[model samples]
Target: MKVGVVLPVFNQEPQYIFECIQSLQNQTFRQFKLAIVIDGANAETVNAVYEASQVLTIPFQIINRTENQGIAYTLNEGFSYLTDCPYLTWVSSDNRHYPEFLQALVKTMDSTPKEIVLVYSLYHRINEEGINVSNSEEMHQFMTSLMRRPKEQIYSVCFLGASFLFRRQAFEKAGGYRNKFPIAQDHDFWMRILQHGDIYFLEKYLMEYRVNGKYSLTTLTPSEDLILESMRSSIDNRKTIQDIPKVSVLLTSYNQCKYIDHAIESVLNQTFTNFHLIAVDDGSTDGTQEIIYQKKDSRLIGLFLNHRGKAHALNAGLEFCLGEYVLELDGDDWLDPQTLDIMVREMDKQPPNVGLTYANRKLWNQVGEKLIEGPIIPGLNYGDKYDVLSNLQTHCPRLYRKSALKSIGGWKRFIDGQPAILDDFLMFLDLAEKYDFHWINGALYHQRRHEKNITLIQQEEISSEIQKIVHAKIKEWGNEYIPEFIFNEGSLVKVDLRPRGLS
Candidate 1:
């Protein structure tokens, strides 16, 4: 079966385009059809592709689009156009393949089972000066960690350079490409198609990825910065975290532009590095999103939305989470360096019945710039679900087990602008109903109280709803678990929210 190669061409230098076509012609395996699709580039760029197709001895076609569609659409169009070919793949005009590239890939696809949807190989990059750089740490490190991990785990950012053969069946089943991701269109395809079947990895280097092009990932424009950030955010949030992160920290913010940088830095400073920070912006008007973008940490996934309520943003962030345990933090709050390791250790010690765990927090005021107090604990004990629900915990500092959180269906908000207050309280109550909780002994987070704090204003507005939810849940449970009943009897909550000496 002849392999169909789709080459998406844009405004690249003519010499570079010719080199891409020349490499394919020199391939050890000759049974391939080369189709070049030109997407509304300049006259010179268009002529380069046309000229390359003329020089080729192999069967080829040139598709010229009058208007610029994009890399994703050009790819999908090429895939659909090549109906007779069973194996499909694409290469950027800026990339060139080794003579043995097609041969190795075809041989592997021939011997492997049909279930193998993709065949990718290691690739080296060529710097602008025509020097061959060694394999990137990203690809090597990625493959090394990937082989040892369980298949159930998911990952993103797996590229075998610019050319990898894909079975038309698998590509078709994955719905081809959505064309939504712009620069990251290929990444989107990789993520979706992975859901269908396994991908085979080859150790041999197959393609040379040229890095000097203006539109290459190496060269980023200011707006493409956001696109690249979103791509990284998407990849980092994918199920397979580096070294299998045990905890996911959901750090949410609205417009704390000044404080968010520190908040992110504190998480990065944590002693426990095996965690992913899913940072969500609740449509910040200021530079809150921009500040988040300033961070270069791979662990931080920055997502931007348009003025969704905090509850909606929180729930939205949960969609990208892939952690076993989840920690909730605010944009104004910062965590102590040892908080993660400590909480993880505490949770590790607890039985599966324990759904949540929290530690004491140091209270600080943004205006005053002074420590308000140290070791402030919730005035609740969590020996049982009843007591924990009765004293609904706020966002002082807590980590939750994902499975138990999943069972309760995550955070709920009044989507139709009912102004869903007390979401954290409801989340606390929901988890408390099914599993117990425990408190660690030290202060690991700093909760900065500010005048614009959402929690401060939401308390009075949501008090009735909090009571109503607690009352309804207790009623639906139809058992001895009663908040009023426990309060009337005056039993201390198993979770002590008092300050250290006070407790």
Candidate 2:
């Protein structure tokens, strides 16, 4: 029933050491033992730590090593001496805890269900002079936000802070801290330990975390490469266990870093939560892949590939989808909060022959810093093969049956050695041929028309490609006559699909 505390000391200041040990001596919970592992500190510092430990009335041990091992090794060495205790925790030499820290953490641990193996609390940030660096209310709010994250997202951020207590059983099961991530050892440990059992967060400031200290790890800047590698390891170690979701949103991005986050957040915050978001980055040089990898949602699966066209990227994402329905979303555009909820409900009411559902879109013309609202482009509630072939506007936010998409082989990669300029339109044509289409009436999609928009930049090429695709599909449908367009001031006013001789 006792808590085993491990204090690993290395080149710490005498004053901080005294304060750290004093805090332990003043703890309200008395059934705890301390193990101080001095890792190759100079004689002066070692003597200071030993002298400071004299105030402890509880059982204590000081294990001094001649050679300096890393924190991970030193911590493991300290814990090896506390095998008799049931609960385990570790502390730094510079941090001081409140008198109620041990009592509150132990009480929570004792009352938690058997599955909860760890409990961590929020802490206040202090300067080198032991003064609060941030407003207490603001700091509490910030730390609480981090601790409120989903358990599956623990790998993304180390919200455990400086105050934590864990069962020795869980610590042993996690195999102790790792030396691979010397700089991010704590984060790596949290990620591994999560696999054993759930963790509880106590919403109290139980300790003072010293920031900007001379010898603090917070002052040491870990390389971006190291941080990214650590994140990759965390993601690889995550075990996803869930039943198949109702919808799979395939989001493809290429050099769209500025708008990718908005697109992703839109999907993640949807009213409908029964969907997995598969984000595919097509070798973007603008750090788009990094943004995707940093997302902390368990429902998000990020894929990074070599530079590929949109068609290829969509096909790549389709390979991993495990949903009954699939929605192909553009990385630059975003859907309304109720987009999935409304679409899923509508699709559920449809018959088996209906393979696709689309909603209206609101256009935002981005000129400089302004986003000029344009007209609402309505969607055809029901479209046949002829309606899809003649309409110039590509429908927005299209949801398709996964089986139907798989039946037509995801997306068409190349047509006449050219990547499909209108990938969505081409796919719509393919779907229109076999399955019926349903459309929702609301403008649930936001389409941003910027200077870099693919449709605007390659207008002529897209038009030409569309003409060729339409011609081939018509011929394949055994039609002898090709459709002609009647234009008014360069805009298509009507489509003449009658025979050429009759026209």
Question: For this target, which candidate reaches the highest lDDT against the unseen true structure?
Answer: 2
List lDDT for all candidates, in order: 0.74, 0.83
Clashes of 1: 10
Q: List TM-score per model, in order.
A: 0.57, 0.58
Say which candidate scores most in TM-score.
2
What is the C-alpha lDDT profile of model 2 across 37-118, one tens digit per residue? 9999888779889899999998999999979998999999999999999999999999999999999999999999989989
- Per-residue CA lDDT of model 1 for 255-285, tens digit only, reads 8988998899999899999898888888898
> RMSD in angstroms, candidate 1?
11.1
Badly placed stretches (over 4 Å) of model 2 are 223-230, 239-261, 269-296, 300-332, 335-363, 367-503
